[model samples]
Every structure is written in structure tokens, then in C-alpha cells.
Target: MNKPEDAPRAFQQAWNGHDMQALGDLFHADATFVNRFGRQVRGVSAIIEMHAPIHSTIYSDSTLENELISVTPIGDDAAVLHSWSRLACGPAHPAGPHVIDTLFQAVLTRRDGAWKIIALANVTLADPRTGRAMLRV
Candidate 1:
């Protein structure tokens, strides 16, 4: 059985690599992805598609640092993870690295003996002057 900690680390690794498929695999089939842009995409296919552009873009370096705030088990099949992430943008986004930071929350579920994310929500925290996110690290 995989611990809840494993899922978050896997998510970070997959995201940094820009591996759309791998990242999608971390989600449940009916997963919901709420981007920082306020756009919500449901299902693994949509999630995969949403990240494809990112992977194709050159100079794109995305890093996610998550501080697990809390974890609650929902019955026996699911868990809710409240976390804050400091997201740093890469060169491809025009803002460059360390220019932006985003906070995120996620809900994960165990399905067929694997832990998958079921829902996610994120928002940007940026510098008012430059309109760029300020990274903590």
C-alpha cells in the first residue's frame, strides 16, 4: 500500500519532467483539475491534454514545492490533502524562474490499489508591481 506522501512526491516529479502521461496517471479517471487560471478540466484525458502544451514548449521549467498542511481520510477509499505549493515559472512563460508562485490544494483517492488525485485547485500569488508571482524559495 502506498502512503499519502508518495502521491504528492510523484506528482511533483511528474510535473517537473513535464511528463503529461505520467502526471495524468497520478489522477483518477474522473479527476478534476482546477488550474490557477480558474479553468477546471475533468477526467484524465483532459488533464493530459491540458499539460501537453507545457511539455512541448521550449524553455519551460516548472517546479512545485509542496508543504503538506493536512491529510484526512475520507472513509477508506479516499483522502483529502491540503497543501501549499510555491510554484516557480520557467523561461518559456516570459516571467522567468522565481518570478511566480502558486498555491494549490488537492484531493486524492485510492482506486484499484493505486493512489490517484481526484481534484485540484490552485491560485497565483504575485508581486503587485510587476504582476509576477513571488517565489518563497
Candidate 2:
């Protein structure tokens, strides 16, 4: 990544393309990630392993769009960022097409002059009153 803000869009683009290799390239070797479902994985290998199958299965026909929320510089080479994203499933999905809104927070660090995610977390937005996933704000 060239800038800290670029990481969120890059991540959504990778997921949309369903390319594990591309997605993995955005992270550091020891990166940590937490999915919307509360699944956590550490290390690039484990992160790829956890995500690859879903990209081929449930999320095979899913498309994602991310809107950057904020990017705060921690130093010259480190930053914390937030993004809002929506995932829309295609008709082929088993439960029928649906949309989910999520919020993501990521910590990125530049190593050897290349920016990469060191830690990330994703959470599904929900309605407190209905106890259901919120598709809109």
C-alpha cells in the first residue's frame, strides 16, 4: 500500500476479486485478523487459510464496497484506520441474496518501506432494538 488510507479499499478489492494471494499480500507475516463472525486468526498463513474457503464457498458470489471512515497517523510508518463496508450476496447464494453492513478497524505499519496491515478487526453492524443485522444507518 502506498498510503494508510489505501489499505481499506485494497482489502475490499481483494475480497471482491476472490483472490487469496492478492489479499494475503496486503498483510504482514505476523498480522492478526478478526472476522465479522468473531473468528480470529493470526499470521498471514492462518489468515489466508481461514478466508480462502469462504471466498470459494459462501462468499463466492459476494461483492464488497468499502468507504473509508478515518485514518490516524501514529507515526511516520504506522497508522490506525477505520472503514465502513457493505457485502452483497449474489442470487446463487444458498440463503438467497442478502446485504450486510460492517465496520472495520485496522492497524497498519510500514516495514521495509512497504505498508501492510499488522492487525484488523471486522464487526457486523446491528440494530439494538431489533437484534438484527443493520443494512443501513
Candidate 3:
């Protein structure tokens, strides 16, 4: 069982490795994911289906700059993690991926001694200059 602090590293590693299954493994079976667009995707399976293609395309060369904001303990077997991340493209980006500043919250529960994300919500910060979406979403 990994500590709650392990989630961010796991997430970053999965994204950087471009491994969909590994990424999905971080979530619980009944997990719900809310994207920056406000669409709610329920279940880990649904999240994988939706993200696989996007990750292969616009975000293929993206890397996350993640900062752990806080971890609040809900009980002995549950916790909520708050994090902020900036998704940016590397030199190999196909068409210059949009840079996005995102804030996310994840609710994790200990299942069989392992922590799994049960819910996640991502909010993209608007561009202060343009007052519009910071990323292509």
C-alpha cells in the first residue's frame, strides 16, 4: 500500500511514460473523473477510454509540473489530495501543445491496503491576459 503522497509521483510517471493502463491503475473501479471542460466521466474504464486518445494526440509530448498542495485525512482509510500542475510541451511536440495551468483534487480511499483515487476533478485556470481558456481543452 502506497502512502497518499505517492499518488502524484505515480500520476507523473504514468503520464511521462505514456502508459494508459498504468495511469488507469491509479484509480478505483468506481472512480469518477471530471475534466477541465466540466464533463464527468464515471468509472476508471471510461476515464481510460476518454484519455488514451487525447494523451496520444495533443498531450503526447506533455509533461506535468506538479506541486502537492495538501493532503487531508478523511479517516483511517480515506484521504483527499489537492494538487496544482502545469502541463507543458517538450521540444518534440508535434504541433506545439497548449500550456495549461490546472488545479486538481483527488479523493482516495484505501482498498485492500492500497490507495486508489475514487474521484478527481480538474480545473484549468483562465488566461489572465485573454480572459479565456488557457488551453485548447
Q: Against the unseen true structure, what C-alpha lDDT does each candidate score?
A: 0.76, 0.93, 0.85
Judged by lDDT, which candidate is best? 2
- lDDT per residue (tens digit) for residues 1-137 in model 3: 28887888888888888899998999999999999889999888899998899788777788887778899999999999988878887655665656778888999999898999999999988877986856433
Residue 29 lDDT (model 3): 93
Q: Model 1: C-alpha RMSD to truth?
A: 2.8
Best by TM-score: 2
Tens-place lDDT per residue, model 2, 1-137, is 89999997899889999999999999999999999999899999999999898888888999999999999999999999999999999876788899989999999999999999999999999989986898866
**What TM-score would every model get versus the actual structure?**
0.82, 0.95, 0.87
Give lDDT tens digits, candidate 1, residues 19-38.
Answer: 88888888888989998889
Which scores higher on lDDT, 1 or 3?
3
How far is 68's C-alpha from truth in model 2 (Å)?
Answer: 0.4
Alpha carbon RMSD to native, model 3:
3.3
Which candidate model has the greater TM-score, 1 or 3? Answer: 3
Error of 1 at 73 (Å): 1.4
Q: Compared to the true structure, candidate 1 yields what TM-score? A: 0.82
Candidate 3's error at 109, in angstroms? 0.3
